[model samples]
Target: MARKKSPTLTEAELRLMEVLWQRGEATVAEVVEALPKRLALAYSTVLTTMRILEQKGYVRHTEEGRAYVYHPLIDRNQARRSAVQYVVSRFFNNSPELLMLNILENEAIDADELERLKAMIKNAQEDGSEQL
Candidate 1:
């Protein structure tokens, strides 16, 4: 059987998700207030976007008084991993090594940051060896 495709969030959806992920649960008003000032979104817009998110299974809402209190159904880390996987598959030919190489080549990494990365790679290699 074919696996169901994961939903990819738009920038707007991600903004709302960020609020939910931070707050754990929020009403439409709360979400709007928590949103970054630059977004300047209207209440109706936030409500509609949240409803769309609910439909997409990224969020779930419970009726609270006169408002719906929304919470993320997907954890932030889970969504981040899925987004990274999608990018790796689409833009890096499904190669995480290529993705890392691209980032290391393009980004400005100071000596300290390079050492941290090397340590992380070494730890990962050790963990992989232990698993084997």
Candidate 2:
């Protein structure tokens, strides 16, 4: 199988990956069941999406009786870090601090999150920060 290099997943694909990340492993029917009602996805839609993800090497399947159990091939944190890097590169002129600043300014981050953010920044500064 050919591995995709830095493939940007579609919204539906990301949603399926989200389910896989949350559940660790699930069947096609289980993924469809977990999808938000607003999506109005059919069972076939989930099945096809899972197959596509499997093809992309982001998801893998195992036989569990008659059903195929799917699990994420990548770690959740790594994907998030990849996505954050993608956004920073594509939208923020490859600057991570700008991305963090924009997020702090826009999103309704609560006090605890703000503290966590501060702690991260502090840790970064103390450790010479991560390279963008």
> TM-score winner among the candidates?
1
- Candidate 1: where are CA atoms >4 Å away? 1-6
| Cα lDDT listed for each candidate | 0.92, 0.87
Best lDDT among the predictions, by candidate number? 1
lDDT of 2 by residue, 26-88 (tens): 999999999899999999989998998898788999999999999899977877777778888
Q: Model 2 TM-score?
A: 0.71
- Once fitted onto the true fold, the runs of candidate 2 whose alpha carbons sit more than 4 angstroms away are 1-6, 104-116, 129-132
Between which residue pairs do clashes occur in model 1? none
lDDT of 1 by residue, 6-54 (tens): 4678889999999998899999999999988898999999999998899
RMSD (CA, Å), each prediction? 4.1, 4.8
